[model samples]
Target: MKAALVGADGALLYEVRRATGRERGPDAVVEGILGFAAELRAYGAEHFGESALAAGVAVPGIVDAENGIAVYAANLGWRDVPMRALLAERLGGVPVALGHDVRTGGLAEGRLGAGRGADRFMFIPLGTGIAGAIGIGGTIEAGAHGYAGEIGHVVVRPDGPECGCRQRGCLETLASAAAVSRAWAAASGDPEADAADCAKAVESGDPEAVRVWLDAVDALAAGLVTALTLLDPRTLIIGGGLAEAGETLFTPLRAAVEERVTFQKLPEIVPAALGDTAGCLGAGLLAWDLVAPADGPAAVTGSGAP
Candidate 1:
């Protein structure tokens, strides 16, 4: 987890990291978060002379942001956790805002990072899994049921691998960093080989690596184009571990996307500027938004859920 004390002007006043400790069980993870928030509140009071005015938390998996419930997170083993109310009570009834992790990150990216000035943009991160945030103006669309921007679940190949969502040929299963690592590990006969190694092999002109890289890129492009056709976003921001390959990924990705587009205006595909901190900064943004204009300084605490 990444926690921060942020000022009203969107400056990070203080920051810290902690383990989610999910291995200890979901109940323990909740306790850890509550304890961490309390510590942060005390830290802000000692150093800045006041407690936080509001708090914001971003969590993974399906979130009912309206009700502040973490509906379900398979990896975290959470179900219908009343995160906002819990945080608010722990913070002495201070207002709290809860958000989806990817959407929160996209919120920050839209207003303060790569998607800045873009009225319509999409933030897609190709990490252990693929997920997206759809940015409209400065806010992310959470959809009617908070399942918006789930482009990763789009079935690009019906006969492809099964996803955790119980569907076959999902975009993430084909093109996510985890998928690339698995493919490269198999092809290179190195049980420990990963996506980064595959990228290096591609740079070194290895045919097998080239094949794997292009395959992932093609899958990614197909998924992206599907999103593009629907959302017509002005900008598309790609982040996460796989995007660390830089132009080795971008150059081919741009070509592939172009090859697939016919009538769609190609949005400027860009790298994420904030990296891992985007979610933290976005969580801060959420906290700040909860503060009224009359609120002074707007000292706020924000947390990122694993």
Candidate 2:
């Protein structure tokens, strides 16, 4: 878990990371988040001499943001944890906003980064797990049940691979960073090989790497074309560790997408401008929103870039 103390101006004041402690059990993970939130609040007051008006926390899982409940998190092993209320109580009634991690990162990207000017955009992060954040206007669509942008569950290859979600040929199973890493590692006989290593090998003219990379790219393109056919987003913003491969991923991805499109408008497929700090910055934005009135003065940085 990562926490950042962001000022009213959306500037990052302090940051820290802690283990989720899942091995210790779900309660331990919840406590870790709550304790870190309290610690961050205390640190802000003591060091900056400013009492934080509100706090925003982004969590991974099926989150009910409206009710501030973490509905379920398979990795964290928790269900129906009232994270927002707990944080509010621990922080002495400080207002809190709960958000999904991927959605929050997409918020930052839409407001301040890659999708800045686009009316409608999709933030697809091809990471350890693939997920999407659908951005419309200034906010994201969390859906009626807060499970809107689960692009990873989209099946691209019915006979490909099994996903942790218990589905075959899901996008994550075939094209996610973790999937690519595992495939490359298995093919190259390197236990430590990751998606980046696969990219490097492909650049070095390794046939196995090329095959693995192309397979992932093909599946990714199929999934993306499906999303475009449904969402018709003006821009498709790709982020996460895999995107760090730069043109090695984008060039072929664009071509594959182009080949698949028939009547749909081709949206710009761009890399996310914010790197790892997107979710942290997004949390800061949510915090600012809770404190600032609708008609009141806005934060110094409207976009919350940092």
Candidate 3:
């Protein structure tokens, strides 16, 4: 888990990182987050002469953001956890906002990063798992059930591979960082090889590495093109580990997207400028929004559902 003590101006005055300690069990992890949040609130009160006006938390998984319910996080083994109420009780009545991790990051990108000027944008992170956040104005459209931007589950290749969502041929199965790592490691006969290693091999003109890399790129392009057709976003912000390959990933991915475009207006695909700080900044925005609504698209809140 990561957090920050952000001022009203959205600047982080102090920051912290902690392990979720999933090995200690899901309940323990949840409790740990609650305690850490409460501590941060107290710290701000002690040092700044005031407590935090509001707090925002972003988490991974299928979240029911509006009600502050962490619906289910497969990796953390969480289901129906009442994060907002728990944290609020601990923080002594401070208002709290809950959000999806990816959407929160997108909020930051749209408001302050690569998508700053685009009213409609999409932030897609090709990380361990693929996920997306659609930014309209400065807020992410969380959908009626807080399940919008689930493009990773879009079936781009019906016969491709099975996803953890128990669906066949989902986009993430073929294009995510984990998928690339798995494929490259298998193809290169190195059990420990990761996506970064694949990129290095591709740079060195390894045929197998090039083939594997191209396959993932092509799959990603398909998913992106489909998204463009549906949303017609003015900007598409790509982030996460695979993007670290820089031109190696962008040049070909751009070309592939060009090849597939027929009638859609091509969005300016750019790498996320905020790096790892996007989510933290977004959480701060949401917290500020809670204290002052009617303010410019304050960070996407648990109330941002749909």
The estimated TM-scores of all candidates read: 0.95, 0.93, 0.95
Per-residue lDDT of candidate 1, residues 1-306 (tens digit):
999997776677899999999999999998899889889989998988888888889999999999999999998999999999999999999889899999999988887789988989999999999999999867889898899999999999999998888999999998999999999999999999999999999999999999999999999999999999999999999999999999999999999999999999999999998899989888878887877422212333243211
Name the TM-score of candidate 2. Answer: 0.93
Better of 1 and 2 by TM-score: 1
Q: List the residue pairs that clash in candidate 3.
A: 285-299, 286-299
Write model 2 residue lDDT over 1-306, tens digit each, in one string.
878887655567899988888999999988888898888888887887777778899989889999999999888888999999999999899889999999999988887789888889999998989999999886888888888889999999888788788889999998989999999999999999999999999999999999999999999999999999999999999999999999999999999999999999999999999888989878877877787733111444453322
TM-score of 3: 0.95
Better of 1 and 2 by lDDT: 1
Task: Write down the lDDT that model 1 would get.
Answer: 0.90
Best by lDDT: 1
> Residue 303's C-alpha lDDT in candidate 2?
36
lDDT of 3: 0.88
Model 2 lDDT, residue 144, Cα: 86
Give the alpha-carbon lDDT of every model. 0.90, 0.88, 0.88
Estimate candidate 2's RMSD in Å. 2.5
Runs in model 1 deviating more than 4 A are 293-306
